[model samples]
Target: MKKKRKSLFWKFLDGVEKVGNRMPHPVTIFAILCVIVAVVSHITALTGTTVTYQGVDPKTFKAGEVTVKAVSLLNPEGIRYIFTSAVTNFTSFAPLGTVLVAMLGVGVAEETGLISTSLRKLVLSTPKTLITIVVVFAGVMSNIASDAGYVVLVPLGAIIFASVGRHPIAGLAAAFAGVSGGFSANLMIGTIDPLLAGISTEAAHLFRSDVSVTATSNLYFMIVSTFVITALGAFVTEKIVEPRLGEYKGSHTEIVEDITSDEKRGLKYALIAMILFIIGMVLLTAPANAILRDPKTGDILGHSPFMNSIVLIIALFFLVPGVAYGIGAETIKSDKDIVNGMSKAMSTMGSYLVLAFVASQFVAYFSYTKLGTIIAVKGADALEAAGLKGITLILMFVLLTAFINLFMGSASAKWAIMAPIFVPMFMQAGFAPEFTQVAYRIGDSTTNIISPLMNYFAVIVAFASKYDEDSGIGTLISTMVPYSIIFLIGWSILLIIWYFAGWPIGPGAQIFL
Candidate 1:
C-alpha cells in the first residue's frame, strides 16, 4: 500500500505550529528587536538614507521637501538612553496603565464571584439556540469596557460551552475571535475609537490643517461589522471550529458552582447598581447643558471630559457594581477585602509587567530612531508609484496594513507611524482619510488574534492551558487562523460592496476626499 499524505492545509498548519513553537518568548522577541532596531539605525545613518516629503512638516509651518534621516541609536548618547529612560519608558507605556486600572475593577468582580455568577445567570437565561450568538455578541461589545473583555469573557466563553457539552476550546476560540479579531468593531464608541481617531487626526493634519477626524469616524461601519463578526463567529464556532475539535475530553471544573442564594442576591445587587449607573450617565450626557458634554460646543464626542475620562469611567462602572455585589454576597466584609481583591489582580500581571517593560523599550527605541517614519514614507512613495486606483488601491492598502500588523500589534502606535505618510498619499490619490483609517482598522483587528506582539496574547494562552495543559502558541494560532482568514475576506467583501454603493463609512465621512 502507498503511504498516505496529510492535506496541504494540515501540513501548513503543522508548519506554522512548529515555527511558532520554535520562536522565543515575546519578551525575548522584543529584546532581539531592540538590538535589531539599534543596528538598523546605525546602518541607515552610515548609508546616508533619507526621505524628502512634499507635505507640510508639522515641526515647521512650511510645505516643502523636508528631508527625514534615520538617527543612529548605537552612539554613546544612545547607550545612555537605554539605561536612563528604561523606567520612564515602562511607566509611560500606553497599555500598561490602562490595563492595570481596568483590571483593578475587574479583579474585584472576579474575586468577589460577581463575574462568575453574572455570566452563569446570563448563559442559563439565554435561549439555547442563541448561546453561541450571545457569547460572540457579548465578546464584541466587551471592547467598550476595554481589556476587561479579555480577562472575563474569554474564559467565561469556554465555561459556557463546556457546560453545554460542547468543546471548551471552541468556545474560547469564538470569544477570542470576537474580542481580538473583531477588536475595532463595536456597537458603541470605545476607548480605541478616540485613541485611533486622535492619531488619524494628527496624521491628517500633515495633508491639510483644516481637516479633522472625529472619534466616531468609523462608527457606522463598526456597528455593521459588529453584526458581521457575530454571525461569522457563530458560524465558525458551530461549523468549522467546533466540528474540528470533535468533543470535549477535559474536566468541567471551570464551570461555575451551583448558583447559591447569596450569589443570586449579589447579582441582583450588581444589576441594580449597573442600572442606576447607566441612568446617571444618561442624565449626564443626554440633555442640553449636560455636565459631561463639551462646555464650548456642548458635544459629548469631541473635546469633552466624558471622552477624556472614559477609562476612569469604565473603571468606576465595573467597580461600583462589583462592590455592590461583593457587599451583598458578603465576599467583601471589610475595606481590607477590597484592597486584597485589587492586590490579587495586580499579582496576576507579574509576567505581563516583564513583557511590557521590554516591549516599551522596543517601542521607544523604534520611535526615537525615526526608522518607522522613514519606512512609512518610503513605502507610501512606492505604493503611489504603482498607479493603483479605486478598489485596487483600497484593497492594497488593507493588505499592506494587515502585513504590517503582524509585526506591530498596537493599533494606535502603528497608525501614528503610518498615518503621516499614507494619509497624505491617500489624499493626493483622491481617497478620504477616514476611508484609509477604516481599511487600516480592518487589517489591524483581523491580525490581532495571530500576532504574538499583541499585549494580551499571553493571557489568551494562559486561558487555553486551563482546558488543555499542552496547549501552546501554535495551538491558539492554528485554531484562530480560520477566523482571521474569514474575517479578512468577509470584511473586505463588505468594504467593496460599500465602496461600489458609495456609502459613507460614518457620519459625514466619505470614501473620497
Candidate 2:
C-alpha cells in the first residue's frame, strides 16, 4: 500500500511537471503577471480603496490609496512612461549591466581561446577521483566571467564525463549545480558583489541614516563558502546524482582529443598574462600609500580604489590576459577580429534584453501601484504578530523568501520589492538588514536550479536537448529537482547553524540583533 501511494504521488508530480513544461517562458509569464497587476491596480484605484500592508517598518506599516489612470498602451504619454521607466530600470538592473560589461573582457578571453584551452587542460589533467571537485570548482570559478559557465563549462562537463566513461548527464548536473545552485558562494568576488552590496546599503539606510555595506563586506565569508559548497557539491554528485543517472549509453559518444600545441601555447601565454595582471593589481593595492587603498582609512575593501573601480579592473583583468593569449596563439590577427568577437557575445544577449525590458516594466508598475510594499509590510506584520523571534524568525524568513523565489527569480528585483518592507520590519524586530540579506541569498540561490521563472531555465533545457532530442522542460526540471531539494535543505541547515553560532554575516555585520 505504501509503495502504491508513492507511485501515485510520482504520477501526480509527473502530470504537474508536464503542464508546467507547456507554460510560457518565465519572462513572458512575468510580463503577463505585470498586465494583471496593472489591471487590478487600476481597478483598485477606481474603487478608491485603501491598501495597507506591512513594510520595512515593523511598527508603522505601508498604507496607500490605489490610484490608476486609464492610459492607452500605445499613446505617447503611456509609451513614454513605459519606455523611460524600462530604460531606467534596465540601467539599474544589476545582472544585465554587470554581465555585459564584464563580457567585454571575457569575450577577448574566449576569442583568444584562453578559456577553452584552460578548461581542456584542467579536465585532461584531473584524476577520476577528483573529477567532481574539479568540475564544481570550475563552476564556482566560472562566475568570474559571468555567463561563461553556462555557455562553456556546462557542456564541457558533459564531454569530460563522457570521456571518462561516466554519465554525461551526471556531469552536466554537477556542473549546473555549481554554476547556478552555488552562484552566491565563490572564492573570488564577481560583479554581483557590488550589485548586491549596493542594494543592501540602500536597504540598510532605512534603519541607520548614514550607513553603507561595502561590496567586500561578505568577501571573507564567501571565500570560505566556496570550498564548503564545492566539497558538498562533489559529495552530492558522486553519492546521489551520479548514482541516480546509473550509466552512460547515449547515442552521441564522447570524443577524446589530445591538447594541440597551439592550445598549450595559448594557455601558457594566458597564464603569464594573468600572473602579470595579478602582480600589477597587488602592487597597486598592497602598500599603505598605494593608490588603490582608501585615502583616509587605508583599507583595501571598505573605501578603496580597487573596490570602487572593480568593474573596470575586472574588465582589464580579462582583456589584458585574453589579448595576450590571442596575440601569442595568433587567433586575433587584427582589431576587426576582436571587435567581431565582442559583437558575437553581444548578439547572445538579445533574449536577455527582451526579458530585462519586460521585467523592468513589471517591477516599475508594481512599485507604482505600491503593491509590493504593501505585501511586504503585511507579511512582516503577520510574522511580528505571531511573536516569532530569534533563529525561528530567521528560518521563517528564509522559507518565505524561498517560496517567493519560486515565482520570482531575479534576486535584485525581488529584493527591490521585498527589502523595503522586510529589512526595516526585521530591524524593528531586532534583526539586522545584513542578516535578512544573508537569509534571502540562501533562499534565492538554492531554488534557482529548479525555478521555471529563472531566465536561464530555457537555456538549460536547450542544453539538455543536445543530448536527448526528446528532452524538454519536464526532463530538465525532473533531473534537477533533487539538487534543488538537497540544496534547499542543506543550505537552510547551514544558515540556521550559522545564525545560532552568531557568526558575522559580513565585515562588521552581525547575524543577530
Candidate 3:
C-alpha cells in the first residue's frame, strides 16, 4: 500500500510538472506583466493619484497620456532612432558583436580538433573523483569562450561520466552548475566583467557621482566564488542528485574509445602551444613597464592594453593551439578544413541565435514600455519603506531577484534594468553597489537551473531524453528543482554570513554604504 501510495504521489507530481513546463516562457510572462503595468499606468493616469516613494519619481509618475498611438512597425523615424541609439550605445550593447568576433578565432581552434583532442585526453587520464573536479573546472574556465562550454563541455561531461559507470545526468548537472551557476565566478575576467562593470558604474553614479566601479571590481570575490560553487556543485551531484538517480542500469551501454596516436601527438602540440601562449601573456603583463600595462596607471585592471584586448588575447590563445593541434593531428591539411571547423561550430549556434533574437525583441519592447524601470523603482521604494536592513535587505533582494528571474531570464538584461533602481535605492538604505550586485547574482543563478525560460532549458531537456526516451521538460524540471531550492537556501545563507562579516565583495568593491 505504501509503495502504491508513493507511486501515486509521483504520478501526481509528474502531472503538475507537465502543466507548469508547458506554460509560456519567462520572457512571454514578462510581456504579459508589461500589459498589466500598462493598464495600471493608464488607470493611474485617469485617477490623478500619484505614487511616490523616496524622493525619486518615475517619468510616468504624473501619468498624463493614455492613448494607443498608431505606431508603425517599420517607422522611418523609429529606424533612425534605433540606428542612432545603437551607435551611441555601441559599447553598452556590444556583447553579441564581441562574442561573434571572438568565436571566429575560436571556431578555427575548435574545428582544428584541438579542443576535442585535449578534452578527451584529459578526461581519459583523470581518475573518477578528479574527473568531476576537472569537468567542473573546465566548465568554469570555458566561460572565457562564452557559450562554448554549454555546447561542448556539457555534453562531453555526460559522455565522460557515463563511460565511468556514473549517472550521466549527475555529470551534466555538475557541468551546468559550474557553467551557469558559477558564471560570475571565475579565475579570470571575461567580457562579462567589463560589461557588468559598466552597468555598475552607471548605477553607482546615480548615488555617488564621482564613484566608478572597475572591470576587476568583483574579481577577488569571483575567484573565491568559483571554488565555493565548484565544491557545492560536486557535493550536490554526489550526495543528492546522484543518489536519487541510483545506479545506472539503463539501456545505454558505455562506449570505450581509445585515443589515436595522431590525436595524442596533436594533444601534445596543443599543450605546448598553450604553454607558450600563457608564458608570452605573463611576460608581457607581469612588469609594470610592459607594453600590455596601462600607459598611464601601469595597472592591468583599469584602461590596460591587456584588459582592453582580452578578447583578442583569448582568440590568439585558442587559435594558435587549435591550429597547431589541427596540423599535428592531420585534422586540417588546408585552409578549407579550418573553415569547415569554424562553420561546424557556428552550425551548433542556430538555436541560440533564434532564442537570442526573440529574447532581444522582448527586451527591447520591455525597455520601450518603461515597465521594467517602474517595477524596479516601486520595488526599491517598498523595500526602503519597510525599513529592511542588512541581511533582511539582502534576503529581500534575493527573493525579489528570484521572482523577477522567473519572468526575465536574461541576467544582464535584468541587471541593466534592476541595477539602475536597486543599486541607488540600496545605497540610500546603507548598502553598497557591490553588495547589491552580489545579492542579485545569487538570486539570478539559483533559479537558472530550474527556469523553463532559460534558453538552454530546452537543450537540457533533450539531454535528459538521452537517458530516458520519455523524458520531457517536465522530467528535467522535476530533477533540477531540488538543486534550485537547495542552492537558493544555501547561497542566501552564505550571502547573509558574508554580509555580517562586512568583507569586500571583490577587489576595490565594498560591502556597505
Candidate 4:
C-alpha cells in the first residue's frame, strides 16, 4: 500500500510548527537571550566595535555626537545591575501592569456574563454580509481602549465565528490581525499615538530644538488606514484564511444563543451604565477646569492626566457595566463572585507572568548593552548613504523599518532609536519628519503580527489554545502571515499613492520638508 504524501505548503507549515514547538518555552528563550546578550556584549566590546551618531545629551539637553560601545554584562558592574535591577525590571515592564489592571475589570464582565451576552447579541444582530467587516472593524476600533482588545476581542471573535458555524481559528486570526496588525491605525487617538509622538519629538529635537511632533501628526493617514486595514482584514479572513481553515471540528462547541429574558434585562442595564460612564468621562475632560485635563495648560491631549488614566477609565467603564448587569440579572449575588472572577483571570496569566519576568530582563539587558541603538544607527546611516530620493528612498526606509521591527518589539523604543537618525537624514533629503514617521509606523505595525518577540505574542497563543489544544506560536504566526503580508503590501502602496498625489498625511504634516 502506498501512503499519501503531504504537499509542500503543509510540509513547510508542519516543519515550522515542529521546530517552534521543540524550542524551549518563551521564558527559557528569553533567559537564553539574556545570556546571549551578555556574551555578545563581551565579544563586541573586546573587538572595540563602536558607532557614533548625533543625539541629544540627556543631562545637557543639547545636540551632540554620542558614541555607543557595547558594554559587557559579564563584568562586576553588569552582574550588579542584573541582580539589583531584576525586581525593578519585572515591576516596570509596561505590559504587565496594563494587562493585569485591565483584566481585573474584564474579569468581572466575563464572569457576570456581560461580555459573552454582549458579544452574542452583537454577532446575532449583525447582518450576515457584514459579519466579517464588523468583527474586523470592531477589532480595529478596540485599540482606542488600549490592551482591552487583546484580552477581549480576540477570543470574542472566535466565539462569534464559532456560533455562526464558521472556523473559530479563522475568526481569531482576523481579530488578531486587526488588533495587533492594525494597532497603529485607529479612527481616534490612542495611548500609543501620544507615546510614539513624544518619542518622535525627542528624536526630532536632536536635529532642531524647536521641532515638535504632536499626537495628531499621523491622524489623517491613520484614519484612512483604519478603513484600509478593516477592508484588507475582512477580505483576507473571508477569501484566504477561512478557506484554508475549512470547518472547525474541535471539541469546544459552546455557543451563546437564544438569550434569556434576564440576560436581555442585564444587557439593557449594562448599556445604561456604560452611557453614564461615558457621560462622566465627558464631564471630566470636556470642561476647561476639568480634573482630568492638564492642570497647567488646560489641555486634554498633551501631558494630561486624562490621557494617562485612559486605561483606568476603561477599566471602570467595564467594571461598572459588569456590576450593573450582574445586579440586574442576579448572576452576581455577592462580592465573592466578583473576587473569584478577578482571581480566575489572574490564574490564566500564570504563564504570562513567567514570560514577562524573563522578557523584562532580556529587554533591560539588551538596552544596557547599547546593541539595539548601534544597530539602528548603523542601519539608518546605510540607508542615508544610499542617496536615493523621492518614492524610491521612502519605500526603502519603510522596508528597513519593517525589517528592524522583527527584532525590536516596542515601537516607541525602536522609533526612539531610529528616528534620531532617520528623521534628521530624511529632513536633509527634503522629506518631512511626519512623512518619515508614518513610513516607520506602517512598517512597525505590519510586522507586529508575525513577530514572536512581540509582548502580546504569548498571550495570543494562550487565547488560541482555548480552541485547539495543540495551537502554538507557529500556528498563530502561520495563521497571521497572510494578514501581515497583505497589510505590508497594501499599506506601502497607500503610502506611495499618498506621496505621488502630494497629499498631507496629517494636519499640517506635509510629505516634504
Best by lDDT: 4
Location of the lowest summed lDDT over 10 successive residues in candidate 3: 56-65
Clashing pairs in 1: none
**Candidate 3 residue lDDT tens string, 414-487:** 77666776778888878878778888878887777776556556456555666765555565666666556667
By lDDT rank, best first, the candidates go: 4, 1, 2, 3
lDDT of 2 by residue, 71-169 (tens): 333335545666667768767755556557766876778777776666567667887799989888888888765555775578668767776778877
- Model 4: per-residue lDDT, tens digit, 343-428? 99888888778877888888888888887777777788889889898889989988888878877777777776677788887777
Better of 2 and 4 by lDDT: 4
**Alpha-carbon local distance difference test for all models:** 0.80, 0.69, 0.66, 0.82
Q: Select the stronger candidate by lDDT from 1 and 2.
A: 1
Please rank every candidate by TM-score, starting with the best: 4, 1, 2, 3
TM-score, per-candidate, Cα-based: 0.84, 0.70, 0.70, 0.91
Backbone clashes for every candidate come to 0, 8, 0, 0
Worst lDDT run of 10 residues, candidate 1, spans 55-64
Candidate 3 yields a Cα-based lDDT of 0.66
- Which runs in model 1 stand beyond 4 Å of their true positions? 1-5, 54-67, 145-152, 155-159, 162-172, 189-217, 242-252, 256-258, 283-297, 408-434, 458-472, 508-513
State the number of backbone clashes in model 2. Answer: 8
Best candidate, TM-score? 4
Model 4 poorest ten-residue lDDT run: 1-10
